[model samples]
Target: MVKAETVDKAYEIAKERYAEVGVDTEAAMKRLETVPLSLHCWQGDDIHGFLNPEQELTGGIAVTGDYPGVARTPDELTSDLHEALSLIPGKHRVALHMIYAVAKDGKKKDFNDIKPEDFDYWIDWAKKEGIGLDNNGTFFSHPNVKDNMTVASPDKNIRDYWIQHGKLTREVSNYIGEQLGQTCYNNFWVPDGFKDNPIDKLTPRERMLASLDEIEAKDYPEANEQDSFEGKLFGAPGIESFTVGSHEFYQYYAITRQKLWTIDAGHFHPTEDVSDKFASYFPFTKKDLFMHVSRPVRWDSDHTVIVDDALLRITRSLVRDNLLDRTHIGLDFFDATINRVAAWVVGARATQKSLLQAMLAPIDQLKQSEYNADFTTRLIETEELKSMPFGAVWDKFCQDHNVPVGFDWMDNIHQYEKDVQFKRN
Candidate 1:
């Protein structure tokens, strides 16, 4: 089942997966002291009940598709997000990311649903209210794709309103920034890549690069603007057929001064090292970073909140490498037709639990320093480098550093154990 109950379900799944059927794992669990599946779980039922106070997450406004039933109009959407943020008193911001469904026709969206006036209105409205937004999946607010209904036949060789959307986005964003009198973060990434026979659809890196160059050339300092890059694991094939870590994205930064990659950890599978595939674990962060942090949703595109163990290791790895600046944790979700606020809460809690797992590291600077150099060398040209097995190498690494608590899940010894058991069972 989709990991609907992130904390509860993940633990249950772990319990089942860890069990050996006839073989014994009770002994193993006893030996390990913990299953180590400590996820960050938060109760998401607080959105409607802000009547009582005192609860909040850290600084980050996750721009998301509207929460169901809760926010419909632009006013409600903006207000709902604000309510979530208010609950977390110490937290100046609560994270958010958008899915197009909020403001568009569900499966068949059109341009009439969105327009420049729509853009002008929201920009002015956000400025007046001092609100900000971010997009993670296909967004109606997106420059080109948002108006998908208008371009009945988008140019295959060229993106539909891609550049136009960029221009509009720039106008709206800058207007908001100037109005809010604060820099608002803009994130870019559509589920734009194909796999296998669909390879020809791979984004022409040069063309995309040129588009980015055009935007950069326009003279709006987008890099200094709060923007990030995010990818989804599942979506309509036209936009979703691509694999997770396409390097074409690298050129995007080559042209612009903006530096941040939105990392949806669950977007990758067990075999891909997201760091290598994208560029480096720290390339985007070298400028600014926005992380779409969550566990890998296996074989499907449901934004379930469970944090994959391997994804956690990636965070620790990033910490080891000093790449936290790019780490604006955006927890995205769209599961069942549940309460809008609860859906947001589910996604938010899952992200938190994943972070808890990420923090498992005991923080050995010496080992991390040594590992960082070696990891980079090996990761030179691989995608999803955070999810590979180099157990022998890691063992030697720990031995060399003389730190006993360091465990790199990149060394897939445990995964191998899990795989072997799956076959046996």
Candidate 2:
């Protein structure tokens, strides 16, 4: 089949899927007019030529209608973006996800390695490519970089390493805070806990200490106030040990005692290796971690999964635990098959909705209860108490506002229920 016809056919099929479920793919696509990079969390190491930020469909609504003429090179991609930008309706914009795995020039460290004027030129290039950092001008740091060191290297004791790293990282954060102003700093999530036996590897407590140092760093007094430090659920090359229960709580107390952590939703599944068949073990107190949203396919945990009721209930539990004070819920996602724009909206709407879901609890009464906070906490986590009713109420609430049952509906979520309103800050 000719490539142009093939693209068109895909667009049509996506549209039909949305129609089958009653989504207005056309209007939703309109919401995708301007592409925002922050909405996407996919990063590092791959370089796929940019395509339509509108190359996404959500709630079953297909945004891009198949452009047989779409170009695949960097130059063509930028031109396509310019043309697409013109068609967007109002102040609204489409969302663009960061496809880091497709990094052709190698995971972004070398923008202009050859030219000495790299930094200035790279910023311009970033703007053109619509590239954005989670927070501005932020990068990871370890305690002994001058010595060519790292935070969780195979050589050090877990706790002490964090202590040194935490102090140093905080200093760097101050620098970022002073430079970026209102922008939050971006944090990578490689500090959960460790799995493979590395006797001296850094501990989460130490990691938290370093993170807190960054938050309260003296150089940037407003470090904590300006942007959050995003902590990861897994350490990756190996999972971090400070996951759930008391250890995580230790870090949560220490960090919030200093700043904020954006909890990613899907980190709970660490590459989604769970099986309904076996007893699964989770390491962190789902409540203690302020989360971002992501879902994994089959069992892949780190992949940011789409937000839904099941994920909401977990956040609701945090409110009961009084843990929300230390967390920020961002929509972290990557959908290879869907348009990046649609995925952004879906994740955004879901986080906003989940925040409100916590508000729905009888906050008035909970305040009066003895373990008021404890009661609220139980309201969300005590499995026996929160089941069918919580979900039923939530589903109905979403319906009132115009959220889809799944990714089956397409269009701007025009149906938000009456008392709910979300504003982007």
Candidate 3:
């Protein structure tokens, strides 16, 4: 166990070190506590919703491991989520896919037929936890995903089905927000694309645009419900030619519609850095943005997040621009190869760590150096800031939040698996 006196002493030392660079370590910790991270629920269940546990993961997405303790029912998933939230620091929201809805009296509701009542349990749970909720419209791993086309399908009925689903999801999001007194971000992501190159690309794009128009036509109070759209570069393997909701498509749509466009960290090319997109897209949109933070290797595989340069760069940009309040950050990775709860803790903590590192940086000094054309000083100070006492501050933050500091959370996770997760057959 970390002693309170030790944590305070370490923080005192870190405060003085950051003070030399004009960074207020105490204020940064308080500001970081206000940042709410939306944790994705699919991680607890390997992206298999309660609607049908046996359904094959389609849309060019796949989960490789069959790790035990995967939540099979809504109750089990909720329990796992509670466990994860306890291990993570700060009060956070949970991001849910529409497919995770719990039907009334065991009666199943199709994606389009789902009502806000179906998510009553989630709203109630969030209320009990004193946290907020966000949601997504599930457009993949379903029978309606014909030829990897939904909302962009040539068939009018198929397009209508997904369009209805999108509208219904917004309604549910509004209801959740109203019940919890917090805005629910309803994000849309479609796996509409082609496996190989297609000559007629414009036709499908036009159809998708029309479908999106219909979906967005539903009027919901902006105070309670916020709408956003996500763009993917391509599918897992087969759908490599083009993804209809490519970054370009959603960027244009979001700009014109004056809505949030979600940037998934792993949705772009492996070599391309999404941190650059903030400066590129935020000007045109001129609206609060959304982000689905994930880690990817060679492909769009939703790997667990770590305290890496990419995450630091993304958060650093947000902090420098003073856009953390306007930006909604959500975790989007799920690694079923390890303990699900542990995966959540690792990703959430890594994200928080990156944000702490960013907040501790001397953005004012760096900007002044740049404005004065002293590029040499800016570069040198930026490089030197990397070795600052960030870990000490982070330890204090965790200690203040009453969460396990350093690897102490591992003991809780092991005990949780033994007491709560492993006995489930």
Worst 10 residues of 1 by lDDT: 34-43
True-vs-predicted CA distance for residue 187, candidate 2, Å: 1.9
Model 3 pairs in collision: none
For model 1, state the Cα shift of residue 347 in Å: 3.0
TM, every model: 0.53, 0.45, 0.98
Winner on TM-score between 1 and 2 is 1
Look at candidate 2 and tell me the lDDT of residue 212.
43
RMSD of 1: 15.3
Question: Which of candidates 1 and 3 reaches a greater lDDT?
Answer: 3
Residue-level lDDT for 86 in candidate 3:
93
Error of 2 at 116 (Å): 16
| lDDT, candidate 2, at 1 | 13
Give the CA lDDT, 0 to 100, for residue 342 in model 1: 38
- The C-alpha local distance difference test score for the whole of candidate 1 amounts to 0.39
User: What lDDT tens digits, residue by residue, belong to model 2 across residues 96-115?
Assistant: 22221123443342211112
Q: What is the lDDT of residue 366 in candidate 3?
A: 86
Report the lDDT tens digits of candidate 1 across residue range 1-425.
11223333444443343232221223322322221111111113222111112222111112224322433234455544443342221122333222222232223333223332334444554455444443222233333432122122135323535555545555544544554555556666543343334544434544555565554456555532455555444333343444332433543552255455566565555466664433354444356556554544453243545545555555555544545444555554444344433344345434433333333232343355457775663344223333322222222222332322122322332343244312332
Q: After superposing candidate 3, which stretches have Cα over 4 Å from the reference?
A: none
C-alpha root-mean-square deviation, each candidate: 15.3, 13.9, 1.1
